[model samples]
Target: MPITEVFKEEMGIGGVLGLLWFQRSWPKYSCQFIEMCLMVTADHGPAVSGAHNTIISARAGKDLVSSLSSGLLTFGDWFGGALDAAAKMFSKAFDSGIISMEFVNKMKKEGKLIMGIGHRVKSINNPDMRVEILKDCQTAFPRHLAARLFTGSGEDHHFKEAKSYPECERFHWRRICGHA
Candidate 1:
């Protein structure tokens, strides 16, 4: 290869590979924006999953790591899964070419949970705060693809219209939950 081609191949391929290798060693070296966001969200309140675990561990006289790990492990298919559900629901709705009530009904039949619809806490059932935060993230980092992934599927409208069982929307906000 010519000198220019050789340099391009090495710099283009090697640079990305080198960065990936270095990332494992510098997990805390995220940009200032992400670090700041993490700090901002660190202690929103005890209702969050991590707070629940820490409180449980402290009360039980267990160590901090164990308690935190207990809480982290609990964040699946229930506590932390709502956002993922919403993302999937939006994807489905977007792919189907409509964010209408019909799309929601079809997805419900297919077992896709709507994201950001209902909350365990916050009786108002508003997801706009979370949306605003995400919009802020998008503003800060214009290249974020997840921002583009938001299909604006009219999920909020469908959720508000579809009456669900009270128990279905109820989230257990207890401090000390048993192991899964």
Candidate 2:
């Protein structure tokens, strides 16, 4: 039933109660599932091409929406479009009912980078270990893990980088030894 009809039928206090009940019991609805997905996406903060571009532009002082639009422009394949291509390769591989070395080679030949293989900052062998945090969160809150994991991972990445500097090391040691 449409929301208008439901409200019209319920009316006044009844309508208010009904809306409150719906909102309070929302987790039982399919809409809640979609809300979870949206939360996950939002938590990622547009790490992809267009989103990153927008973030960079915003850092340089573009207004909110226009900066985001600038970032969205980079989402297209011609810029750094590998997500769809990688997904297609995975689908083809899975549908073929085989996981042979030949199949892997075929994906490589087709320019698939084996999702989550490389970090723009981390070296080829030392990929980020943020997956461990997600794994831990999964046992507690599986539905919300992905969204929260993205945020936590970004923070962990920055923290690790910050601590890598000699200045950060000195500051940390001085504070720990009560030299500050």
Count of backbone clashes, every candidate in sequence: 1, 2
**Highest-scoring model, lDDT:** 2
Off by over 4 Å in 1: 1-49, 56-73, 100-113, 120-180
Model 1: how far is 89 from its true place, Å?
A: 0.8
Question: In model 1, which residue pairs have backbone atoms overlapping below 3 Å?
Answer: 86-115
Q: Indicate the TM-score of model 1.
A: 0.25
lDDT string, candidate 2, 29-109, tens digits: 223333444444454454466767887889899999989889766765544455666677678878988675877787679
Error at 121, model 2, angstroms: 15
Reference-based TM-score, model 2 = 0.30
Across 63-174, the per-residue lDDT of candidate 1 in tens digits comes to 8788788877767664677777777878877897985788878857987545678654444564436556745654454222222223234233333345321221221101
RMSD of 1: 21.6
Residue pairs clashing, model 2: 50-71, 54-71
Tell me the deviation in Å of residue 143 in model 1: 51
